[model samples]
Target: MAGAALPTAELTTSGRPILLPNEIECSLLSNVELEPEGSPPLSSSIHLRSSFLILTTHRLIFVSDSSAAAANTASYVPLASVTHIFLLKKSIKSMFGSPRLKVQLSVGSDGRVGGMGTRSIVATLVMRGKDDVEAFVDKFRQNWGARVWEREKESESASSGSSLVVESSASSSGFDSRGMRVVGVAGILRREQEMWESTDKSLQDAFQDLNALMSKAKEMVMLAEKMRLKLLSGPSQAGSSNDEELGSKEEMQDWLLSVGIVSPVTKESAGALYHQQLSRQLADFVKIPLERSGGMINLIDMYCLFNRARGTELISPEDLLRACSLWEKFDVPVMLRKFDSGVMIIQNKSHSDEEVFARIKLLITRPDALQMGVSAGDAAMTLGIAPAMAKEHLLTAESRGLLCRDISPDGFRFYINLFPEIRTDDIYLVKDQGIYATWIKCASSPSRLQ
Candidate 1:
């Protein structure tokens, strides 16, 4: 294939492809090779031996595990351009090694891979990894034959037509003509009662069957979003509502904030690239929550939040950990970190312990805290991290001579580092304006007040 005008697919920061509108990823296979039977240029760029193959509804995408290599070598073939898919020759040889899928594609007059042309070439998909080749082919064929893009186009046009007709009818039939004329308070109350009953009945009918609920899931998400917007627009009055009611509403709002992933990565859906795809999705999903939590969140908490966002497609703890670990391989903004005590956290790459230490310094040096010191939980609240993580940070800051820990009958606590500021040569000479001086003043002021 020569200048066939093949479009290069753009990838996310985490190396996942930017999916086209309505294009859902159907399957994936790693360690795949694209061998062109007739073209030599294919032997150069499209060869992509031992690459990761991703099958979408609209395109066949290949990516390299290495980010640098992928930038230069990654490419895709449009399903629309595929002329034919050859049946895999299953023999004794195929059972022993990797499986292969051969498909014919239309090329350009100059022999280039493209969407439309006269020339053609046969391309083979060699799955070097142990994968179910037959199932992949079935999915590929199903996606190709479905022509989902065309169906989506037709559905959009139909929806537009239907919406226009309904709007026109509603405009022509005003309140009086629509059988519900606004007369008085009693009439308004009756109309509102009728509307509520209609909505309740619709919800009852919608949830009657699994199939109906699945069909209405999108509508539910839109309705949740509308409610969330309304809540945000309303007046903020913390004392106006009871505590339990407010807590439940806040929890509901959190769920409605991120309704679902639309298409979550699953082992059945992504196959060999499940972890990779899930990693990218998790990276994108955690940005907002991580920012809200001050650039870090407990892994256990993230597990709950992530699964809630995934709805029915819940990932296991192992899957979440693996996905978080894969962030190191990609250029993801978030990274997984484990403390020496085995507590794990998901944090932004740019997040710094120095920043946490600075906040801790400010906290412990407070007028009240300087008298009694700060506990791990106190640091956690100020830093917006787990108590365990905050303790680890405090210990680290202690090691770095930024703080000092004291264990007493009262409790475990941390004080602003004054060991370095204290002069051993002159025990009674306290610095005038240093943290040491502040500590001396705080330590004596409480006695004076007593």
Candidate 2:
């Protein structure tokens, strides 16, 4: 923890920072450190090492690059709180040492960073990499000058205040701004109709052209996220939802969740570190879908899901593959695996083949399974995975001597590998107690085979 001086940034399971509502990442630096300036260190002497600097439209975030506590080890300086940014000075000493950019931040007496404070502190961002530090500083200055967050705050404040003003005026004057009566059910109905008309007009205008849709994309993403959250809380908050309603809500939630990525890592934003940052973002994005697919998903399926979430900012297949390849260098929980058949998939490092094999063993050892064997489709249903993935597991189990493959006119099926338990010398000899014995008992029952 960096203590109370700097608020910690929230991160997803795969270590990507959670971007604010409309905050967009504008720049990224792979290597940087946050160091306090002056001798009598300003309240707690906050310091971060080997951190990746991410400059968004709203804040300057420093995220630790190391694997341990990567999720928790992040702090940000809101652009709103930054009083001044001093770019790296051109001097002979700068030639031999790392470039440093100084940022003056508003600090309160409580030793916390905020919008306005009685005192201020100067913090130095030590840029270790020689990779385009000038560009990042330029972007920092640009974002600060834009003051977009302030504009958003002003808009939100105005919108919220407008409704109260209307209600207050209507109550006092007994009429709305449009001269409609305020004391009856007809007034309420008229207001509701007006709201729906406005919404319909907005929707119609948004779909008028591609450029119109592009402009409204952010609003749509925000609306989707809001609806998804509402659906998520609906069941828990209401408690009266039936199974069908709950199931439908869950399905709708899944759809809305994939509607968009509010702040996607892009080549323009990440620059030289594009693929690396994209890899981290992709790793974080895949966690949910991977879990749903039983801890593994084909790379093709992942690409589709990822690009869908990214919306218009789609990546080329080559870029996606390159990003996935970089995962081995990072300490992410997920990894890309290529099976013997050359089928590539993304699976968790903690995913155990033995656990999957155990499930397969249980499925195949049943009396019905023992008599007729199990097909890839059968395993797919039992495992809740794709038939292709199920087949891979079945083949791996067969290779490990846990099961045996049986091909017949009906279809490809896997049966328990009882060769190890069988007596080769005696053709009819069966083990009194073992998998072979179980198979014999099941085979002897005509009804079971049928």
Model 1: which residue pairs collide? Answer: 1-111, 1-112, 2-111, 2-112
* Cα lDDT tens digits for candidate 2, 1-32: 44346777887765678999788888888789
Candidate 2 local distance difference test against the native: 0.84
**TM-score of structure candidate 1:** 0.77
Give the whole-model CA lDDT for all candidates, comma-separated. Answer: 0.78, 0.84
Indicate the residue-level lDDT of 202 in model 2. 76
- Runs of candidate 1 exceeding 4 Å displacement: 1-5, 36-48, 67-73, 90-98, 104-122, 174-252, 326-331, 377-381, 384-389, 406-411, 423-426, 446-450
lDDT of 1 by residue, 1-450 (tens): 321244577776667777886577878887888877764665444455666788898898877656542353457888877889999878999888678788888876765566457878777888887777789899999998988777888989998998897586556542433566456666557656776786687688779998888667666776678778866664375557777777878787876777666667889978766887798889888988898887988899999999987887899999999999988877778899987778899999999988887788889889888888899999898877778778988888888888888999878998887888878899888878888888888888856478
User: Number of the top candidate by lDDT?
Assistant: 2
The TM-score between candidate 2 and the true structure equals 0.78
In candidate 2, the residue pairs with backbone N, CA or C atoms under 3 Å apart (3 or more residues apart, or in different chains) clash, namely none
**Over 4 Å off in model 2, which ranges?**
1-5, 11-13, 33-40, 43-50, 65-72, 85-103, 109-112, 121-135, 151-177, 182-197, 204-215, 223-259, 448-450
